[model samples]
Structure formats: structure tokens, C-alpha cells
Target: MKAAAFDYAVPKSIAEATALLGSNGAATAAIAGGQSLLPMLNLRVALPDLVVDLGRLEELKEIAATRTNIRVGALTTHAAIEDGKLPEAFGGLMQKVASKISYRAVRNHGTIGGSVALADPAADWPGCLLALGAQ
Candidate 1:
């Protein structure tokens, strides 16, 4: 797991992260939880010169219900979504999906954003999310 020297920042707001991305153009990237990206970095598949960690962005940790849908923050982890503390609107789908995720340990840390961002044709969540019309 080798990585090159790079600049790292824990941006408290989306504006700061946006500024970092804009300044560096494609050389910068956003990382939440760093589970997948860390492995990619170790394998040398990505080489972002700057990583804007959004771990401290409390505004992005929301899981709220709208009139017709559940609005999950892009950074919300699977565990949070499956916490079973959500309003009745979600219909236990989150919990079902959460339990069937890769593994309990991984489900705890894996974010929904990571699943969709993977863009993998064979990912487990993709089927369920698509079946639920969550694209």
C-alpha cells in the first residue's frame, strides 16, 4: 500500500471542498470514509494530488424524509440508513438492503455513495436500488 506525497484537507463545508476541487481541477478529489479509495490508492489505480475529506461535514450526514421519498445524504453510511430509526416511510427497505450488503463489518462503514459511485455492473446494491427505482 504505497502512496505518493500529497496534500490532505478536512474541509468542514462543501464550499471549501468545491474550492479545493476547482483550484486543482481534476487533480483533486473528495473522499468520505476512505474505505474504497484507500484500497484503490494502495493499488495505484488513482493518484489524486489532493483529497478533501468530508468526514466532519455534519450537514451532509442527514437522513430525512420528503413527501414522496427519503433523502439520504450522499455521505450517509449503510449502517445509519439501516439503523431502523427512520420514519415509517422508508418501509424497512434500508434495513433489508443494509443487512444483505457485503458484510456486517463493511456495511457499517460503506456509504451508499460508494455503491453507486462504484459504477460496477455486478454490485449487490445496484440491483435492489434499481428495483426500488433509486437511480
Candidate 2:
């Protein structure tokens, strides 16, 4: 099935996205890579009145690492992790997990934030992140 009709917005900044979401209330949905949300939208499981695309927000795509901590941006793709784009501090754990999520196509567009936000019991990232003491 195809998704129901909905308006789409591509916000330039986090604040703009937040305002869009708040203005629309419960009828709004935010999409990053759309790995999880797209399927639900197509199946009519998520019929949001508006979809705020966060893909182009550069702030959400950053990655920073310190001596003892690492901050991964929400828009980071699984393919990036699988391809060793992250700092070596993780000891290849994230790489191994990213390689195993569905398939290459999905990994190319799927994001760590999307996976975690879905909170699917069978999903890999959330449990892995939780176990690693992710904040």
C-alpha cells in the first residue's frame, strides 16, 4: 500500500524543524534516513499529516570524538559505521553490528538514530548502544 497524502518539509536548522513539529502537534513526524518510518508510512501504519525531513540538517550529521567519549550524530548511516568511518575507540563492535542490519541497501540509508528511535525489540542498535552505556 502507498502512504496517505501528507505534506513534507525540509527544514534548514534544528530550531526550524522543532518549530514545524510543535506547530503541527501530533500530526507531525520527523524523518531522517526514513529507514524505519518509510515502511510504516507506506503500510499506512503512520499517517502523519506532515513529515519534516531532517536529512539536510548538517548539525545532525556531525561526529565528534574525545579521549574518552564519542558523540555520533543522528543522521550517521549504517554504511558509514560498517565502512569504518567512526573512531577506533569502539573496537569494531559498532562496525560488526552495522554490517548485520538487514542488507547493504538498507544500511546505506538506514541511520543509528532511526533504529534507536523505533525501539524495535528485534533491532540491533538500541540494545547494543544501551549495553555499551550510550547516553
Provide the TM-score for each candidate, comma-separated.
Answer: 0.84, 0.95
Top-scoring candidate (lDDT):
2
Per TM-score, the best of the predicted structures is 2
lDDT (CA) for every model shown?
0.75, 0.91
* Residues 12-116 of candidate 2: C-alpha lDDT, one tens digit per residue: 899999999998887999898898899999999999999999999988878899989889999999999999888957678999999999999999999998888
RMSD of each: 2.1, 1.0
Give a tens-digit lDDT track for model 1, residues 20-86.
7688987776788666877887787878899888778887778788788876777788777677745
Lowest summed lDDT window (length 10), candidate 1: 85-94
Q: Estimate candidate 1's alpha-carbon lDDT, on a 0 to 1 scale.
A: 0.75
Candidate 2, residue 93: the lDDT equals 93
Off by over 4 Å in 1: 88-90
